[model samples]
Target: MQKGAAERKPGETDDELLHKVGTGNWRAVRLLDYPVDRILEAAGAWKAQAAGIVKPWLVWCAHPDWAVLQQKLVLSAGWTPIVGFDPRVSHVPIVPGSLRIDFNEQLQLPLMYPHFPVELAFMWIDKIAFWHSDFLLAHDMMERVATQFESLPQGECFVTHPGHPIRTRLKWLLNAKDARYWELLGCTTKEASKSQWDNGTSWWMNFQDHPNCPDKVEYERRAKCYYDHGSGIRYWHQKCGGRVRFIYETEIAHGHFTKIGNPDFKRSIPAGQSDSLRLMEQDMSRNFGLVEAAKKMRIEDLLSSD
Candidate 1:
């Protein structure tokens, strides 16, 4: 019994995307209907925010559905897709750049949204998180790496995907460097770990049964425009059950509350009263510590064929 996708304001920053979880802004993170270029622009904008210099980081999600678009980006200008991975996805970790962006993002699409399929949403988020991260690196190779949205101190927002509580209690881990990455999918460091049940220490955004799992195509829609090229397009089956919706809703909830990585149930804050603004005082400035976001040099390695 999770809430439905919220409605977004006429024009909102990505930060508003998280409002639905706690502030109850009620806006759906609906980038699905927008044009592919729009998505690229969104990716580019976030990249500019993270990295001081605006270098084009050609990015595409690993999902096969986006394969055509990936090719187009590479062919049109300077863009490439790699250095991204989805646990549910196979054969990724595309390596065009020296830095690989990683992160988990959640969207609360309805079980019966006529136009969008949850699977597609998941693919998009997974890809965008990577895209944004690399976009930052592609831009000005800085000494410091900052997030697009205001960044919270490590353990400020704990996200976990199959996150481990035991690990949190221990707090022993270090990510690789020269590899610009974001835990977009849903992750939390030791400070952010909440004991789900002593089940595990990894704090993650746990949606009960996210429809994004890519079950079966609900129906086949003619690629109308793209079909002229004969690359058929398919959408997710909206007929999914509640389990699917529940999983997404759960993660949406966890993402907002525990974002600062204070997932401890006792740390719950009143909805709409979150410290997000204070949290994101700046878009992402190199002057800041960017604890999780460390900068890298050697921009050419990003698209390296290595």
Candidate 2:
């Protein structure tokens, strides 16, 4: 008789067990260290009562402050915010009833693993939205998106706005010194280098109806490629057969450096460049005020509502 599947003996490393049983053994594959099942169950409950509400799931990493602000904005806009967070960061102070899923201990993989959190969100909801932490949503953004979604033919599955050409050009110029930028763009010609891709700041999709929806394995494979090679836009464009609609003009404004709490733009600028420092200060002075005002309004509302 064939032996029963080997149980994970005491002290057996996760990698060893994974190799032994592979991913087919769901019991052996410990995906998250935290009580994600509980969180997802709570989300399911919330979703039951979420009729006519715009519920968007956001993924957070290395930016708790921004997460808090974004959560408040989501709440103020009358949308439900589901945040998937890196457990390594301090707990984000979100209002009660918001679902927060910790992902730091989920998969024993590199920090850049982007697939699992998104996949987790999709599993729970048929139609879901995603936004970057750095984006500030206009109060009417969700309403606009809902209107657009309602108007689209059943075949047109995904909706988002075009990338700001100015911002795209700026990013390319700023990263020109980095070899990673060249590798990511995969182009030697100036025209190819200058090409602008769609900004993925705020987008929603009905994956169930998406004609080109990929299976789990293919989706994860593409996600890994995105993390390793910065090819997410390319992957999405190709998968959706280059058929994406741009709706709701400028519903989201990117905070860029301020949203990430990078006061000095250290990540983008070369060190000790006085000109760059001055430019960063000017930009931050204008942009940070906007973020602060929005944050303040949310805080006041939370206090008053209580």
Candidate 3:
């Protein structure tokens, strides 16, 4: 084997090689077609680290004050919480039973582009469950999922979205198998459709929003490299031969719903949790945001005392 070349050792397992490439020990590997390599490569460039299983959920959070309460609930459930912090926000308070990471450090890139570090979390954790900072799991969430969480098959994923009965019915009627409504849903251009690739392409192709975005055909080719269907769950399921389970429930509460000013917007706050959310926000505002009332006291201030 050549020096500096990443050569597979005798009897080296796929999981071991996955760790190497994932941690940047091997930089980038090619020729050998492994599913792990393909998945991580699709996400982003390699970064330095050692890999090991950490938890079931990767919580991406920007505000520690807001997420601290949610973190406590996650810990009470005996579930591991890995918080992905947006580096720019450093005033996050330390919460127990949670591992905090910086997105800039992990991705080795700036946070200007809207991207999810799913590959990074998947490499360190057994399952890939990505949770937004604003969504708080119900008190009974872990207990409810204990059985299914344990029995979940390898390569399978479980996703939860804003569930509305009426919207769900309309979507089903439009997307049902052999349905004629599919014709009406077809997009004339790739940009017209929302896909996982939107994050990668938005920097260059979002002319109306970005204004400075280049209007070049070259960006389209770049977008294709990250392209996945709007039905990403289905695409990954078929590509990787895994099952994607959509948990249709109203239990997972979205914190933003409580603060939304738009009267027409639908809110999905779980039963009996609205008061808690309001109280938590009030406490944060009174204590953390009072000094810098214009903004708020940050995770840094919360941590400085500790």
The lowest-lDDT stretch of 10 consecutive residues in candidate 2 is 178-187
Q: Write the candidate numbers in order of decreasing lDDT.
A: 3, 2, 1
What are the lDDT figures for the candidates, one per model? Answer: 0.25, 0.37, 0.37
lDDT of 3 by residue, 208-292 (tens): 1111113434333222322221233333333324344555434444323234345442323344432212222333443343223
lDDT of 1 by residue, 105-142 (tens): 22321111101211122222212212222122323312
Cα RMSD of all models vs. native, in order, equals 18.3, 13.1, 15.8
Q: Write the per-residue lDDT of candidate 2 for residues 130-238, one digit (tens) a residue.
A: 5544445444654565455444442223433334545644764566221111110010111111121122210111111111223544433432332222233334444
TM match of model 3 to true structure: 0.48
Could you tell me which 10 consecutive residues in candidate 3 have the lowest summed lDDT? 179-188
Which of the numbered candidates is closest to the native, going by highest TM-score? 3
Each candidate's TM vs. the true structure? 0.23, 0.45, 0.48
Off by over 4 Å in 3: 1-54, 106-108, 112-115, 119-122, 165-172, 175-230, 237-241, 253-261, 264-306
Indicate the residue-level lDDT of 166 in model 3.
Answer: 62
* Best of the two (1, 2) by TM-score: 2
